[model samples]
Target: MQFADAKERVLSLHQQLQEHNTRYYVLDDPIISDAEYDRLMQELIQLETSFPELQTADSPTQRVGAEPLPFFEKVEHTSRMLSLSNAFNREDLMEFDQRIKKATGLDQITYVCELKIDGLAVSIRYQDGIYSLGATRGDGQIGENITQNVKTIRSLPLKLATPINLEVRGEAYLPKKEFERINKQRADNGEPLFANPRNAAAGSLRQLDPKLAAQRALDLFIYGMDGSSEVYTTHQETFRAIKKLGLKVNPEWKVATSIDEVWEYIEHWQLERSKLGYEIDGIVIKVDDYALRTKLGFTAKSPRWAIAYKFPAEEAISILEDIELRVGRTGVITPTAILKPVVLAGTTVKRASLHNEDIIREKGLLLGDHVVVKKAGDIIPEVVSVITKERTGEEVAFHMPTHCPECNSELVRLEGEVALRCINPACAAQIREGIIHFVSRGAMNIERLGEKVVILLYEHKLVSSVADLYYLQKEDLLALPRMGEKSVDNILSSIEKSKGNSLERLLFGLGIRFVGSKGAKMIAEHFGTMDAIVHASEEDLLAVEEVGPKMATSIVTYFKKPEVKELLSRLQGANVNMTYKGPKIVHANDSDHRFAGKVFVITGTLESMSRQEAAEKLEQLGAKVSNSVSKKTDFLLAGEKAGSKLKKAQELGVTILDETAFLAEIER
Candidate 1:
């Protein structure tokens, strides 16, 4: 076929497949059979393969097998992706209600309850109703741009029926069926499988090439808007507007008049969630009145007018078929409960964490006992309670071993801690886990080195300590399975590149006890370099803000280890960047007049500026840009239909401003 003719044919096939996908997957009303859709896709692939030069980035055949990128470029979000405060139990929900009432001075309030999807949060930008950009909520301030991949989602409207400029926030998720299918394919290909749908979604979205992201069969639901040419006063109205624009919105959302009704909505979904094809971790409850939402205000990270009511971990009765113990990287031995296969929270539960001896003793779990198992955060499985009433007298009581399962070293429980430690530095399990942690994304972010590669290196004895990784030769790596010359070269390059990462990343990579990313950054900032950090007294460490006595002791103890010192010396010899510089430090004190004392609550996506940039600008003008609407809020910066907060702000009679108005106010 001629190149132009093939291109035309491919475009037609793509449109047809998109329509079929929307009908089958999004609308749950298929007009065509799976076999027919497959045939159409196959034809498009054939045509694209024949005329490769004619294939466009948006073509359906380009979803997979794109060359890996060097790195993901940073995309600044027009609006900050604020997270919701969690309400663990009924009491917490009640407290949230009480706080809202006190702040808004209202006798009662309405709430909009929607399922909190256990997936990746994404923002899709549309210009004149045409899909423009899609980004992940990276650090709430910046995200990776993935517009071409997002366009492949058939449910997402590439071009809206109405010509409107807007930004919509939604959860990009892999359905259970799709996740299973992809994992099965990976297993067949001898590749590592994703642990869960959330991981799969995250991995797919972060693929630097849009073609790889497009092939993931990802789906989305529009839940919030940032800025829109059209106006929406309430959360419900916003949903309607999004639906009117031919975007997918969750049908399960409901408006509640009181907290009890909100609880009811949550309870109803807790039972119904399993029936749905997708995964939802909890229910998000938000104040319905935009004006009232403004009056209720926001905290630094989350909003006071909203809370996520997570369901208690989904539990299922399973027989304690066997008991096993595994030693962790920290030398702590964890008891695992091997169960008779039972489905829980949409996945099959085969094992649950016993945590430690205290938990086993507290629960009185025994072999052959029918026990209640659950997945904590829909990820880690744990035994919640034992159905002891059904336990047969023949069931045996299990005891934790006194020796490390991997190293056979004597386990010792510390003075105050419940966990028993193996203290054996050379334990195979500990070495493997430590190496994995050292290369983790939040740590050194070693590219082309996943957990599987780390384990392979450990098994082959190519790497024993974290320092050994830096010394590995391309030939040494090339000897491993699936490691060709090209792959080995890539891995070596990534390892070399990681050596220049900031000091904060190195500190976190060390896996120091009680030291997280934030704490590591603080320590790096205060100490300036690794040498200073190692030499600093515990008292000096403690003097740093947010670093308490426990953390101080941990830092001192971690550096005191001769092995750790050796690793640091090797890293230094390799010319690794060991000093902390700091983040892109932008000061908001640049200006101070127009926005003084004016509280602005920004919602939805902005066009030219990121949420952080806008917030910084507002702050520079002496304005307080809060996450939620509250009584102190003088203006509700409505982007698109700004959700329930917008409605609450309206009900409370707070002044509303679109992005243009907000920008104008800031300019003044």
Candidate 2:
């Protein structure tokens, strides 16, 4: 095909994909199936490959992502993203109404009440009605540019109906259904679960890879915008205007003239919040009139014209039937309370995590005892307390397991930890969990080998360890339940693909004690090869910055085990890449690195570099970057609207540096 024809086809495909994205994401109506979308995408990709000049920044194919960014650059907001004061109860709401009325010198007021979505706050900017820049709410005045990640969110329109330049504030959230699905997937893969929907949304948005963000199924709700120059006169009208321009505004907003009416709206939603798709922690009450809101003015941190009414946590009562022990990848035996099924926060709760023995004892939990259960963050179910008054004399006190439930090995509580752990490396439960973790998304990322598939493989003795995955035959996988020819082929393909993952992925998959993804990456980059890390002593490991005593010891301990070494040899024999494929890290002592002796505490968004980048740069220069500000801190790296850390630094007489100054210092 000619270049012109390819270009035309690519343009047509982009338009089709954009429309489909809008329909599926914003409208919740899909006209095409996943297979059809994949076919279109493949055609576009081939066209782009054949005619490279036809590729554009706004093309649908670009959403797969580029190289991982070293850091996110900060963008200063045209206007401050002010927070709202919280009103916990009806009395607080009444007081907020009175305060607003007093401040505006008016008795009558109108408010636009919106759901205070429990997710990451974002600012999306448009230039000539085209989606341009997007940022996170980092200290209100400055935010990290997340334009690429924002573009991956299908509900977010790439272009508006009108060609007017404007900025809108929205909440980027993962729906409750998606959150549950992802968490269950993670649990099955033996990965740590997301605590809540809000946290999951935040984590998804902040992902360095836009493709990762895209897979999260993120949605947005544009509630407010800088409407000072707009034709709209009220907050209620502004919502309608944005919605007309292909923006998603929550459909449940209400116009309330009286505080009592506002209370009624809040009370109704508090009870019905579970019925909604997304999570809302509270309701935001804003003065309906834009002119009135302007007159009301703002406080240092929050707008006087707006207030958030937080809902009280909901709870339900159920009988604790039994306490069951579940083994984790780390061999930690967690006690879960199996309860009589009771509905709480929209879902039926059958079990609640008792956490550890201490929590069980503190809660005085017993078998067959009536207990109050609640969903923490509308996701994790937990026993709030035992209903002692309802408990009968027949109740039996719960106890922690003395032996591994699956392998029957004696469990031991590690020094400095509360939970009992099974230290047997060959334990069936630990081995199964470890293999599952090895194939998780953040690790080897074997797509078709999910938790259930791994369990099946393990049960049939087809796979015992991570290395065994690559050795599985077609007949072995085909013999398992639900394993068709296509399924077996897909699993084999994914397993083969995982062998090429970077060294950090392998290190993380190994389930090293006290080593997380970040630590794994640092070790991988610093050492360059898994062999180097395996041979390194604790002292040698400690030489690399970010390698604390605990992590260094853990790495040394992990590589020292004969079983671990044997596993590594097997993986090596399987032709798995054992070298770092990502960027290399240079030691501070290797060169004349600036900021070598300085200690920095970053507070807000940096204009040139992401917070992680800044911290990494500091580490590369031998600086000890800490999360919290203290007397020991040499400098407080303050950005726009720097919070309590800035104030604390000022009080402590620590040097404060803006993004520009911080950059200059590093350069010097």
Candidate 3:
């Protein structure tokens, strides 16, 4: 299409999308289906692709930036984002009303009561009604610039209705459903879970990559605008104005004419919070009129016009029903506490990890004892402590079992380790765990193939080892309970795709004793091929920076096994990638090499090359490229959007160089 025609289509699409976004996010009603909205966005993307000149910052398709930032730069707020004082009970709210009435000499002062969303506080600025900058509230005065990250929030408008300059404050939150989804994914990938929705939202916004932030499904609720009465007199009127300007405001906000009304609003929300899609910790009460807020100005850290009423802490007590022992992928025996169901943190608490035998002893845990329970990070169930006074004489003292529950082998406590391990190599439990680890996120990253599926495959006598996964057929998966045509296809596709992963992933997935992901990467890079690593002597293995004597011995011993040799042969036959794709870093002590043994750190977007490519280039030339900058860093390669790391480098007096300088030095 011609540029003029494309531009017209793009403008039309933008208007349609803006209306749909407002309808869905602000009004909680969507006129179009998600598929239909995606089709429109796809059309806009195509038009913009053909006519790059028509693409603007405010375009809906431009939500996620093309590149990630190195670090967040500091931004100054036009006005301080003051916090609110706390109100614990009805007496506190009544006291606040009396104090304000006595000071202002007014009767029945009207207030705006809003739910206090448990999220990150952010300031968004607009220039001529177009979104310009977004920032986190750091110490009220200065904040980190998160403009790119915040732009990914779908509910936030890129351009206001009227072309007028304004700034608004909102709480950026991860919805309860999204939080649960993220935690589930993290659990599957063997990553730590965020304690709650608040932490999840904060972590998402702070992500360096705009693409990552966009995937988090973050939402915002605009509470206030700086320099009140700029467009409206009352606080409630300000909400109306911003809504007209295409901003999202919390619909639950109510005008309270008296302290009784405020208390009633709080009481209603306190009971209704669990039913809502989002998380709220308290209620925010603000004086309704802008004039009244101005008269009752600022406190040192909080506003005299408003205060937050916190809810009771989320906790509960449950009875410890029983203890269950389980074996890990590495044959490490772990204990789990089975609890009588109790409601906490919007979910029922049933079980908590004991981690190992030592933790159970430390907590003085007993079967049938009443235990204080809470969700750790609001994701994992945890037994905080045993209520000694609530313990009955019928409660049984718990002890670690002497043997593996699956293999029936005698467990051993390895030297310098607290956990008991079942060392039997042919242990069925260990074999299943090894396969599970092979398909995990940091390894092959085979999606949909979870622990339960792996257990099913083993129990059904279909697969014996990790290599056997490659041989699974469509019929085999279709046989599993609840496995349908589409789900099985996806799992099979994921398994096939994992075959092309680089050598580091395979090495890590191999579950080599004493060798972690970093060590595996270094070893892979050093040898350049799986064959070389398997055949390498201890001395050759020791030459790698991350490999030590214990690690080298372990690697050598692992490869020497006949069964491992057979597994490798099968994997090779299956056509899995066996070679490192990056430039080899080990150079056998070429002292004349530039940057030999010198530490280097790369930051931001490099125009000439990707960060990983640059790291490989430096590593090949004998430099140790680190992720973080410190006093020991010999050089810092800075590119566009470099911020915190660059500042820290300067503070540490490390040698700082732009991309040009870095390229010149490395090339020479």
- In order, candidate lDDTs are 0.78, 0.83, 0.85
Error of 3 at 533 (Å): 56
* Each candidate structure's count of clashing pairs: 29, 0, 1
Which ranges in model 1 have alpha carbons more than 4 Å from their true place? 1-73, 228-230, 314-316, 322-338, 341-352, 377-380, 399-668
Name the weakest run of 10 consecutive residues (lDDT summed) in model 2. 643-652
Top candidate when judged by lDDT against the true structure: 3
Writing each residue's lDDT as its tens digit, candidate 2 over 1-668 gives: 98777777887998888788777877778999989998998999999888888987667787657655666787889898776677789999989999988988898899888888988889999998878898987656777888888888878878776888999999999999999999999989999877668768877887777878888888999987776435778987788888888899888999998999999999999889889998988899989998887788777657788888877766899999989888998889998889899977655789898899899999888899998887744447888898899966999877776889989999998889999999887889989999999999878889998999999999999988888998889987888888899999999999899899889899999889888776887789888999899889888888876789999988888788888888889999999999998655554465465666667899777777778678767766767677777768887787653544764464355666667657876787
Task: For each candidate in turn, give its C-alpha RMSD to the true structure in angstroms.
Answer: 11.5, 13.5, 13.5
Give a tens-digit lDDT track for model 3, residues 1-668. 77788888999999999899888877889999999999999999988888889899899998986598887787889997765677889999999998889878898799999999988889999999899999987546667799999999989999899998888999999999999999999989999877678768877898989999998999999998988676578998888987889999988899989999999999999889989999998899999987877788776557788888877666689999999888887899988889998977756678887788888899998899999886633346777888999866998898788888998999999999999999999899899989999999878889879988888889998888999999999998899888899999998999899999889889999999888876888999879999999999999999988899999999999999999999999999999999987556655276466687888888878998988678778777877878777668877887765545764464344666666657777778
What's the distance in Å from true for residue 176, model 3? 1.0
In order of TM-score, best first, we have 1, 2, 3
What residue pairs clash in candidate 2, if any at all?
none
Residue pairs of candidate 3 with colliding backbone atoms: 195-377
State every prediction's TM-score relative to the real structure: 0.58, 0.54, 0.53
